[model samples]
Target: MSEVFERYERQYCELSANLSKKCTAAGALDGEQKKQKISEVKAGIDEAESLIRKMDLEARSLQPNVKAVLLVKLREYKSDLNNLKTEVKRLSSGGNYLSARDDLLESGMADTLTASADQRSRLMTTTETLNQSGNRIKESKRTMLETEELGVSILQDLHQQRQSLLHANNTLHGVDDNVGKSKKILTSISRRMNRNKWIIGSIIAVVIVAIILILYFKLK
Candidate 1:
């Protein structure tokens, strides 16, 4: 990230130097060179803006005390980039180049200082807001982490309960199988007892009839 910032700074410095040279020249730049330079400057500005946005996100991820200082620096970098873009645009416009160049050379220092002071003032005024926003982001992330942990805990408990229920169901099935086997044994025993009772009664009646026939023959 610092590398990105440094690259942007170098490109801005080069653009500034080129603009200063053009200011000193009494004539217009070669058409092709001017167009290429403008294109390069524009690309540099876009890259710088992209880097600054990344820096802003990095700052927001930090602690509030650290984020506040970084936010201020990012704002300053943004302001400087805006100023450079304005100067590049002035340099690229052929019709107003002379007047713009003269004005830039004359008032650049005072204008930069003034812009710096104004940016500092604005940053100071918004420090509390920036800090508050950083704190909110920090809190939100913390809450999300806690919620994720809680969800994991709940899933673990549910899994444990499911395992317990499965064990209980298996035990119930084993008991039911044993009860079914006991009922089948009892039914077989009952059928055997009924068959034996009928055979014993028939044997007793046959013996009594034999005794009566023997007594009657002896009396005759």
Candidate 2:
């Protein structure tokens, strides 16, 4: 498990470094190159998020104390990734809206034609955004299912432990009952032995007293 975590950590570090490099280079690039770099960074961000989620699931299998520590580190990594993403997004979007408006205005087309073209462009963009959202939703559903399975597995373990504890408790109760019976038997035996001792001592006293009376009568 630790090995898996370390593997993910290494992958994340490489991805993060690559994203940083791209983000830095994005500023120096022109036109298509800049857009391509931004796209790559976006892809890297998705991968990083996926890797972090995997790490979170892996952490669930660890001991609580260890999981807690790992989760803290993962959270920090997530935050760092978010910052990188923010930087990349800002770089990518800088002047993008203005550029789009300028292009639309400079197209030298009729007003109605520009409006129609802009409407089509906006529609395409919305469609693509919706598709991306759908994909994200599916991914989220899959992650939820996996988490549910893990929860069920942990619950099963707890159920088994509960059964074991109950069995142990029953066994202890049986032992206690047996001990009580043994103690009662011992008490009965002790009482009987004491009564026998008293009877024997009384018999000896009677015999001695009768012998003295016999001698006394004979002497008289």
Q: Give each model a TM-score.
A: 0.46, 0.43
Off by over 4 Å in 1: 1-115, 125-130, 217-220
Query: Model 2 — TM-score against the truth?
Result: 0.43
Give candidate 2's whole-model lDDT. 0.73
Query: Which is the leading candidate under lDDT?
Result: 2
Clashes of each: 0, 0
For residues 47-70, what per-residue lDDT tens digits would candidate 2 score against the true structure? 989998988888888999989987
lDDT of 1 at 55: 70
Clashes of 2: 0
Best by TM-score: 1
Model 2 clash pairs are none
The regions of model 2 sitting more than 4 angstroms off are 96-220
Model 2, position 102, has a per-residue lDDT of 44
